[model samples]
Target: MSQATKRKHVVKEALGDFVTPTEKQQIVKVTGSRGNNLHEAVTARGVTFLVSMPPKFRKNLWIKRGDYVIVDPIDEGEKVKAEISFILYKDNIQYLQKQQLWPEGFTVEPDKEPEKAEETEKDEDFSGSDDDESDLFVNTNRCNYQYSESGEEDSQEEAS
Candidate 1:
């Protein structure tokens, strides 16, 4: 087929519904690019290795650091041990998490709620202050001028 048709097909397949990894495939977090369509990634078990991006996904899909992808391991390569099969999006991650298929190391903690509550309390406490010193540094550089019909300045006022 044409190049455009191939790209469209690859993109559609990459973005299609989430599919669970097979026996030989596993999820990995991309660490950095290794050049020549090769990427360095870490698996859920903390093993680091290189993965090759397929030609179809080379330009159609862009993978970056911290992005998760499912990789199929290769038995022949020494340095490049895997090939990326699918790139995970937010929805796909959530779906995998819901199905209990997501790795525990990749789960996000919900510890920010208490921090947000503390910040709101601090803001409320500061809002109750009536100190006039807070306005000591008010901007006084504004100038408003009113012009008459002749275009001459009639009056000038300094905005507070």
Candidate 2:
């Protein structure tokens, strides 16, 4: 099978326990590229955020400007930033929209500045410590995608 086909199959098998987004995780639209795995995005409420792509997504998913993505904010009192958790594929976005589960009022107006209050709100939404941030989602990068026909046990175990 091709790499993309394998990835899709694995993603389907692994997403059995897909967790829905909480209030903290907001859907944002990529406004511009910031280079080095970072992109400028605007939240549904028009909050401009600096979104960074985690190495896992950078390697596995293709993200581009104007694409809608899920972002989890990482605020440390100095500057506001977010890590891209899920890249919204067209089908995923369509499903969310069809179910009316999409974040309300999502827009990507250009050259918009995030207000101070909005920035503070975003900061407050990120109450967890830095360590907790990494635990929010399962890291699929460590999964073994290759299948063995013999059904033999391997030295390493995949996370279920």
For lDDT, the strongest prediction is 1
Alpha-carbon error at 15 in model 2, in Å?
9.7
Q: What's the lDDT for all of these models?
A: 0.86, 0.70
Clashes per model (N, Cα, C within 3 A): 0, 0
Q: Candidate 2: which pairs clash? A: none
Compared with the true structure, what per-residue lDDT tens digits does model 1 show for residues 1-160? 9889999898887788788988889999999998999999998778999999988797889999989999999999999999998999988888898999998777753246578899999997897676657656655696746555752333333332
For 73-158, candidate 2 gives per-residue lDDT tens digits of 79772344888787776577767777777776752232243675677777878764355665566667897576766634543344
lDDT score at residue 91, model 1, on the 0-100 scale: 84
Residue 126 miss distance in model 2 (angstroms): 52
My TM-score estimates for the predictions, one after another, are 0.68, 0.53
- Number of the predicted model whose TM-score against the real structure is largest: 1
